[model samples]
Target: MTLPLIHTPYAQVRQALLDHTEIALLDVREEDPFAQAHPLFAANLPLGRIELDAWQRIPRLDTVVVVYDNGEGLAERAVRKLQSLGYQRVSLLAGGLQGWRDAGGELFRDVNVPSKAFGELVEAQRHTPSLPAEEVLALQQQQADVVVLDARRFDEYQTMSIPGAISVPGAELVLRARTLAPDPRTRIIVNCAGRTRSIIGTQSLVNAGLPNPVSALRNGTIGWTLAGQALDHGADRRAGEVTPAQRAQAAQDARAVAQRAGVRHASLADLERFAAERGRTTYRFDVRSPEEFAAGHLPGFRSAPGGQLVQETDVSAPVRGARIVLVDDDGARAHMTASWLTQMGWEVWVLDGVDRSAFTDTGPAPATLPRPSRPVDWIAPATLAEQLANEAPGQTAVINLTTSANHVKRHIPGAWFVLRTDLERALSTIPSAKRYVLTCGSSLLAQYAVEEVAQATGARVLVLEGGNQAWADAGLPTAEGEQRLASPRTDRYRRPYEGTDNPREAMQGYLDWEFGLVAQLARDGTHGFQVL
Candidate 1:
């Protein structure tokens, strides 16, 4: 049965933000369109991904969720899906995206605008020290006593880095910086793909009161390239183990910073109490490296490496005003990450004094969800290949429900890329066939859509056994590029700093955007950010 859609006015949403109450303003469009424009605090939970992500992102069933789309007729569908998944308080943003604009709301461009804006605010308030790429390069040329720390993920560091930078991702900076540069006179420079992590990471060291002078590599690698400086590709340098004494000192320093920033320390009992508060949304994150998280972690804690957590808080925790509990075995990482969270207006706590044995769970954090009520028909890769080879030209319709980018990168040779939300309409454009096959990155998403597709088409519907990955692993031929597209490539937003070939204007414009975030934050007046 379809539930009557509840309409929430723009005033109510804005009031929720200003009042510092829990509100999840979800943009239900794909990433590309969402990135082009969204409210400052809006989180992108695309329509195709509601079933897979809604539960994990908005943990509470009663959490106020207002979903919007830019006149694409997706918000109503999203509301229905959320209702089906047990979201009790789902509502449509009255008048949709245009309503927010008409109500004089600020629409932010690019993803993670809240965190990026916070970083800019921190830099503006704290005057976080930074050195331009050219100046840093000159210092390197002069053999200055400096150590460059890449604050991005290890894979990102491996892709491109400064000539002599080491991969000490944002969260590791405070815990490992002293060990990386034992000499008190050594100058430290931190960087990321762009500005936010660089500012946040550098400020973290300074906030911890690290002795050696620290500064961000202004605008990060983007600045390096813009300044006609070269980047070292495939660099493997990473931070090593910290000595006991170093760990102790780092812990002490980080704790002091956390305290100053009003970060609370929670005991195991306190954590249990927080968990019991079903009325309040509490997210428990193991703020450690992915490898460390996979090795061992407390039960119920999700893996969100500290740096990325701070950078992508909207993605991780969409419900603003929710409580956050960060866990880490190491004394420093959690505290350092918590310090940033506190400043970002999160009611954050660091789990303290927990015995190592408490970490019973092992391997990657499990993604648990309710199984589909109806059984799904699945086709193995080999069987699909045989059917494709033997069947008539229009016998089977293989619809790829993965991201457009992923579909373009690699997919079954004759597969048509279609948005799961647009399946019925997209199918009308495809040739009639005897059977239809559905697949995504892992077929997890496609499995959820089996009933919907079967209902809409009244055709034999089957999911690919393991999706595209299985097809490739079976040594089957794959095709690339935009061969057949039923929907625009809007699933994933192409980041300005991701690849090597971004236009100079776009890069500069990106940097220019960062420069103006502070003003935008002021205009919005809802962000409860504080800098220590």
Candidate 2:
């Protein structure tokens, strides 16, 4: 007997989008491949990570989820995985990516096309003001009243930024703009690595009804670099705190904007009702600074800085179309963050009117992870240390499945570093041993590989009790070098746009790719984007 076929055609998907119906148009490929070519609204949920990240990325079991790959045969496999996981409305893109091409749809390169393209659209439609990078530099050199704000994350800002730019991040722009530039006559300039966040950040201030004149640094740091300008590194300047009066005023202003975007506030009772809906996936995020969240945050909430949350929705809340509730110590941050999220096509709500005592968690929130169903043996750290110290060579083999960079930095002595995906084939080449141990920075990844390793090699497989960290804590020495690798490093891909060593052409190529996203989004026509 053959299994039934499920297909979602391009036209059907397009119609649903045009009609404003909800759908999770997913592309099941790795981040690197997914960056090469995909539709504007297609969220990448790689096949290798389906079991790991699927539940958190797609919340509703019955929601229409159309997954495709570029004829890589991953979509069908993903469909099976989703079905096994009890998803009811999973379907394959009719002809995979070829179907979209056949239907004359545009394929964009790089990630976050929706948000980036939306920025371009907003700039085009609203005519957000801007200055060339050179002009902005000159203004800074002249000690003009213009204040530059970096809209990227704090780390990214610290890496490289326009001269004298303070790190304000995307979602913080509206909340902190008034405090940063209280004078109505002060000019504000917003920027990011390239164009998206700069455009969005500048427009956010405009939308918030800031009295000062606002403009984006055209093309952002890319333009600054192209014009032979210098970028500051390791800059630690950040926006200062907002007072009680400022918080109240910002809350009122942000709440009005959220209302305009149809984002409602959720009371404690409303969130309780949401939590009760077990089948529906709901993500509750504390959208505050990492330091603030670590001091204490509401229970059952993950820490996602509001600005980074807007910049990387796929990373933060991968569950496309899931209901998101944002929490902030002050009401303004959540409301402002929710406003952008609402515009980005998310059903978002801000928690309001909660007492200060309601927030109650220490350290980071626990991760959302899935465990494999397998019977696995564990060797305690002390036992492993003793075995390493006393056992003869070739008696037991320890394989580290952590990242290559991390492995190079330090790993358990005599342990071989291998990629988890390549463990089976690589195992055959290694010297035979009576026992095998799998470990990572944590034991979670190692547990998923125990069954596979055991089945492939017919060996007694055991997991390190608490991974490599335990061995180190037990005073077991570690090794450092690339010579201990048992498999070729294929797990992590290096981004071309990162770091200071990138060639001029690669940087130029990245900008060219982003500048074309707006055109591709127009041709795709599946993205239901609205700019305010």
Candidate 3:
């Protein structure tokens, strides 16, 4: 006597999902079908990925997967793929998803896990609180008790944050929180556009055993906007800085802590002696985020993301076996990075830059930029503009090299970012067109971007001079922020191409390159192109 065929009726499947919180109910239907209707607990895995990218979507093969589709042939294929992949607890909802609805089961709409929901979850268990728009306004008016920590990049923070928020990215929280909130009585509040980082940031302090209570700005800037609060950038409101006395104390405290943590504190003489050793393979790491790294970092130091550097130091520096010197404008980053590296068994040193300029001891031959009066061998913006004027429509590719925030904030008519940190992932996703213009905050970065592209694949490369700042400052028109996720291509990690230097020419090189890219496009065929 055989039992019923072990069939999972729609009701049973629904019950199974509700019974196990860990179970993942996957909607295998195409977007249209899922948009129309899907199980309340289902996460969309799109039918196509169930075969190829399933492993990435679901890391644990044993995760209970109840797959379904809208009466299409896709679900069966998805199930077969899961079975082949050794996903042990895989099952099918006896009938396609429609059957669940037919049986009076509930359906969910627009239920993608949004950043806001995640933000709330992060705030809830993490003791993260957000000042509502009214509260924030009142705080501003009352000269409040809370300190807003803008957990975005320094540049993003510079561009915008709550009126009094300070720029404190996630990675820096563990290191800088102490200085910012010295009293522990100071209420610490973290914020990010959507969530993730803000939530993680607030939790870091709580996890660090810091006695201070921490909270995240509920919903970040978006939430602030939703609540009709005012936002500002450093342009109008600058980030808080440690005063001279505070800076001195911070430096002293940092040196003592660093020494105790096993990080070698090197004097200028010590650094010189180390540099004198010929043949010794030593790599310098500027452990700040790329934005800060670009703003100004130690001479000859390469940018290595702090988190990745901590996790995979050997990969980032194969000379990992070599002596490593870490530099940072403030002792916080240098010490934090050094502490982590010391634990990894590397010979690490922290250069004391509190009193000395990190760039002061450049060997006799200092790093230099091209002279503005230097002969213009590269295709100048004028030349590119002239040629572009002659070229037929659709014959050019537009590669914008501006920062994502800036690109979103404003950009040349059709420019795109050519060197995003996630270039490989973004390549397939970016639009393929005829011409490409490497862009950035300034033209030098654009040129640096062009060099990167040249090394990878040969395509038309045009560098914008002076970059976006010049264009905007010149009173030129610009786009106002990309409202959605941009092609990953534009999000490349740019270790080079900073804005401190001036082009031999171009009064407004930065802004012209980014905002006036369309004007540059008018010139297409000028010769003598060298990307330096």
Question: Pick by lDDT: which candidate is best?
Answer: 1
Please say which candidate is ahead in TM-score: 2 or 3.
2
User: Which RMSD values do the candidates have, in order?
Assistant: 1.2, 3.1, 18.3
Model 1 clash pairs are none
Tens-digit per-residue lDDT, 1-532, candidate 1: 7778899999999998878788899999888899998999999998888888988999899999999999998999899888989999999999899999999988899999989999999999999999999999999999999999999999999988999999998899999999999998999999998999999999999988899999999999999999988899999998989999999999999999999999998998998898788779999999999998888899999999999999999999999989999988878999999999899989999999898899889998778676875699989999999999998799999999998989989999999999986777888888888889999989999998888778878889999999999999999999999989987777888898877789989999999998999988888888889888
lDDT of 2 by residue, 166-271 (tens): 9997878877888899998999999998888888888888887889999999988878888899888999999998878877777788788888988988899998
Q: How far is candidate 3 from the true structure (C-alpha RMSD, Å)?
A: 18.3
lDDT of 3 at 507: 21
Candidate 2 residue-wise lDDT at 31 = 65
lDDT of each: 0.92, 0.80, 0.54
Best by TM-score: 1
Candidate 1 lDDT trough over 10 residues, lowest sum: 365-374
The lowest-lDDT stretch of 10 consecutive residues in candidate 3 is 523-532
Q: How well does candidate 1 match the true structure in TM-score terms?
A: 0.98
lDDT: which is higher, 1 or 2? Answer: 1
Ranking by TM-score: 1, 2, 3
Over 56-84, each residue of candidate 3 has an lDDT whose tens digit, in order, gives: 34545565567777776666666765766
